[model samples]
Target: MPTIYLSPSLQPFNKYLTTGDEQYWMNLIADDMVPLLEQNGITVKRNTPGTTLGQAIRESNAGNYDLHLALHSNAGPVNLAGKLRGPDVYYYPYSSAGKRAAEIIADNLRKIYPDPDLVSTVATTKLAEITKTSAPAVLVEIAYHDNPQDEAWIRNNIPLIAQNLAMSVCEYLGQNCAL
Candidate 1:
């Protein structure tokens, strides 16, 4: 069974700022995506201390996992707070596998996000999440938490969001396990 390392945000401020609270949505994502992968014959190793960004990364590299997917919500600069909106996928600029995974996720998000410009960004060298991973990795900022509309969508569409992402992973890996 191929293992997927699921990383959701553990940011302290997210609860205070978002409508539905952090764990509610994060768990919805993790739970929904996990079964979809399992149905497609992929085994998911959900990271515990589950919402911690750094701990998730550490676990993804701790063994022979096939993929590392970091999930998060976006927040803009203080001045642009509650203004920026959209789903943005991210990849390590130099890794081909990372780019492929990112494209798969971006393609899926493009279908669901109202933003026509939904796409992937190449992470800079200083970004620890993308830089330190040993496996193919992409961090998805699913929506802008700071934007009211985006936050509302996030609050309301947790299942759809997870489904879109799960389908992308199944599509990318071509997992067909009937087990």
Candidate 2:
């Protein structure tokens, strides 16, 4: 079975404009994703809620995982806070596998997000989770937590978001995702 290391955001202080913190909602989505992945014959290992980002990367590196998927809601730069919207799926610029995974994730997210055009795949080397992991990695910024509309959308569609993400992972792994 293809294995994944699931790292939900640990940023409890990054509060959503409408309801909960980034950590709370990201964990809820990750919680929903686990069973769907398992049902599709994928092995899922997850970071603990309180695990620091460094610790999560270390744990994922120690495992023989096919992918490392980090779930998070975004926050724009201070000047653009609460104004920016949409999902940004990120990957290490040098990893083609990471780019493929990120693109697949962004495409899948476009199906559910309000504006399909706003969902994009970004290539970067600054993120620790993507840069330090042994497995091919994609870090999905599901939506802007600082934007009210985006926050509400995520809060209302946790299960749908999780399902879409799980399906995307299955696609990347070449597994059948019936749901």
Best by lDDT: 2
Report the lDDT tens digits of candidate 2 across residue range 111-169.
99999999999998999998999999999999998898999999999999999999999
After best superposition, candidate 2 residue 155: deviation in angstroms?
0.2
Question: Residue-wise lDDT of candidate 1 within 1-179, one digit each (tens)?
Answer: 67777776666457525455555566678877888788787878766534466777777788787778877788888899888888777888898888898888988888888784855565555656778888888888888877878888887788898888888887767764332
TM-score, model 2 to reference: 0.98
Candidate 1 CA-lDDT value: 0.75
TM-scores vs. true structure, each candidate: 0.88, 0.98
Local lDDT at 19 for model 2: 71
CA lDDT for candidate 2: 0.94
The 0-to-1 C-alpha lDDT of every candidate, in the order given, reads 0.75, 0.94
List ranges where model 1 is wrong by over 4 Å. 16-18, 50-52, 176-179
| Candidate 1 lDDT score at position 79 | 95
Model number with the top TM-score: 2
Stretches > 4 Å off in candidate 2:
none
